[model samples]
Target: MNRRRTPRSASAEELLSTLQHLTARARQEVGLHQARVELAQALQGKMLPAALPSFPGIRTAARYAPARDGLDIGGDWYDAFLLPDGALGLAIGDVQGHDVEAAAFMGQIRIAMRAVASTAADPGEVMARTNDLILSMDSSLFATSSFFRLDPATRELAGARAGHVAGVWATADGRSGITSDAGGLPLGIETGQRYPVTRRTLDVDGVFVLLTDGVIEGPSLSIGDGLEEVRRLVSAHTGATAEELADRVLRAAVLTGHEDDAAVLVLCHEVTPRDHG
Candidate 1:
């Protein structure tokens, strides 16, 4: 009798019930995640997000991804605005920690940056003033950032870096690589420090990218190798729109594992053909 005994299979009703429970659980989890994200953003109370700002001959796009196990938020932030002189101001940065204070500090830094940029002559002065402002806060927080003044007519970017990652660039016609920008210490460290300004012009149809280190360097990836991978990707995907390009880069980083909060800003230079009339 034992030799002929076999396990009984579950009925159709039982299997169906199990599937239904799993589906409902998945939906519940997704809703909870969305609620948490909204709550966190509401708590921050400041919008440092980089929404696309319109400019002649330029299409701007940005993406932000939180750490894998983060509170669905962190110190990473990106911002773009029109300067008083009509030039476009672009910035991306990360504060020293990942907490409520860090998020608040990031917001302050952005607001101060815009205020200083209104009167500052160039990217260098903007950063120096922001640096001094942070020191005045009396908080021990430090941050790394990149500030750029983009000239729409000339297609030139005047930029300054403060102990942050150098940006990457590419074109619609297959030219791509990392930018070489000299920089100074992270903000909030010294009372008087100078950040070098790097200026470069983009050819028509070319694109310039600004990204936080979280997008490239990870636990399983080295910054050097990650830079090369990004270079190859940007060069190969030449026909993508600014938004598409930004998403593709973020997707790649997610695949590698997002060890920190990530943010990227893209400037797509588009030139219109002259009218035949």
Candidate 2:
């Protein structure tokens, strides 16, 4: 006897229903992912400085690179503005963490630091006050920052660092490095701790490069190596405009797998004098 024909494994209707369910799930997942990506993009755009301030006799350029694999924004930031007294304020800071919380904290710290600098004129005292403010908040939050007051007339830079990467001064002749003072811990570490200031009289036609750790502590490169790279790049591009040189250094850092948030600020003393009519 002919064996009963095996029932069809699945009716066309049943197969179609299963496929529809799977497609719906996939679409929902895709929609969620897209929303996340859009949100991240918006956040990243917001985190960066919308417009850098313009100062007389100063051409400032900044670049920020977020981690290649993660969110596009982090705690790295830069600020440059002319003080009321005609002195220029140059600053770079990194909040202790990443994301929205860190960005908010960075904004607050940067604002407070600038306010103090504008009024105090002493980099050390500004940093000290900033540290005190940070300490007053939750101890868990902290930041690493470097602030500099530039006097175009005097060609002097009064600087203070709070656990930030050191500032490098490179001249057409040679390269010199400046480090933060000892016992100057990162902000929010302790109240009443003093962050010492360092003063340097930059040579005319010299270039000062300040950057966040994202440029130095990159993968496949040590801090020293990264710094050396910066020195070399700056030296090679001595003839390049300050903005162009800044762009080159930032590009080099990004190429070298500096996946964290990165920022760079450069100050170059123009060799030519402006005609004051």
Candidate 3:
């Protein structure tokens, strides 16, 4: 009778060894995920402006918030720099992913924009040149951006957009509306795309608010609704300083259970209300 003998149980040391190996592997995976998250965070930290460029008669404040509970980093970025003609240049953009690559790409795009804008005279030319540079890299990713050249003394803004969401602006007398500028396709879409530019001057004590889509759009919300919401926020809080207004806008976005990264840049031409006399 060739009956199968009962299988012997694994020895205690053997079982312990197997468990130790599994535990090591589990911990290794956890550590790897954490390391990747940290690396993305670092990339994002370096990509953001350490301090927004300060100029006379221009009070600027910017804020950036991560998505997914900080488990990942998205490609939202804001930059303020000095243009060649002494105009203050400002930009807000969102790259198309949420990972280390996105963060790195965002950093490169901001640097490229600053470099290109410093020498370019027209907002349209700046966008075209930047589009070409981004395509030269052969990256498959795309990005949406809003660029502005502002004369601090006049608060005259020459703006361009590349498939970005509309920004909201508020005047000292409490009038607020979408920036409603002409726009082009997002960068990396095609070669030689020309972006249209618009020019507007902020009234004394006027404010212009720029932000990523993350601030406005939610799963159930449309872009138009989000824009209106931001406009209301801006109009309702004109009394707030640039910093306070930035916080208010960002706080509203956060309260809506936002699932993406958000960046807000608030520019106030003058803090004091315009004299009606």
Model 3 Cα shift for residue 4 (angstroms):
15
For 60-166, candidate 2 gives per-residue lDDT tens digits of: 67777775544455778888888888888898988866566777787778778878887888888888998987777674778888888888778688888888887
Over the stretch 175-241, how does candidate 1's per-residue lDDT look in tens digits? 7889888999999899899999999886567778888888888877888777777778777775677
When sorted by TM-score, best at the front, the candidate numbers are 3, 2, 1
Number of the top-ranking candidate, with TM-score as the measure: 3
The per-model lDDT (C-alpha) reads 0.83, 0.75, 0.86
lDDT of model number 2? 0.75
Tens-place lDDT per residue, model 3, 90-207, is 9999999887788889988999999999889788889889999999999989999999999867767898999998899887686889977889999889998999999987756777
Model 1, residue pairs in steric clash: none
Full ranking by lDDT: 3, 1, 2
- Residue 77 accuracy (lDDT) in model 1: 82
Each prediction's total of clashing residue pairs, residues at least 3 apart in sequence or on different chains, is: 0, 0, 0
Pitting candidate 2 against candidate 3, the one with the higher TM-score is: 3
Q: Model 3, which residues run further than 4 Å from truth?
A: 1-34, 69-71, 271-277
What is residue 201's positional error in candidate 1, in angstroms? 1.2
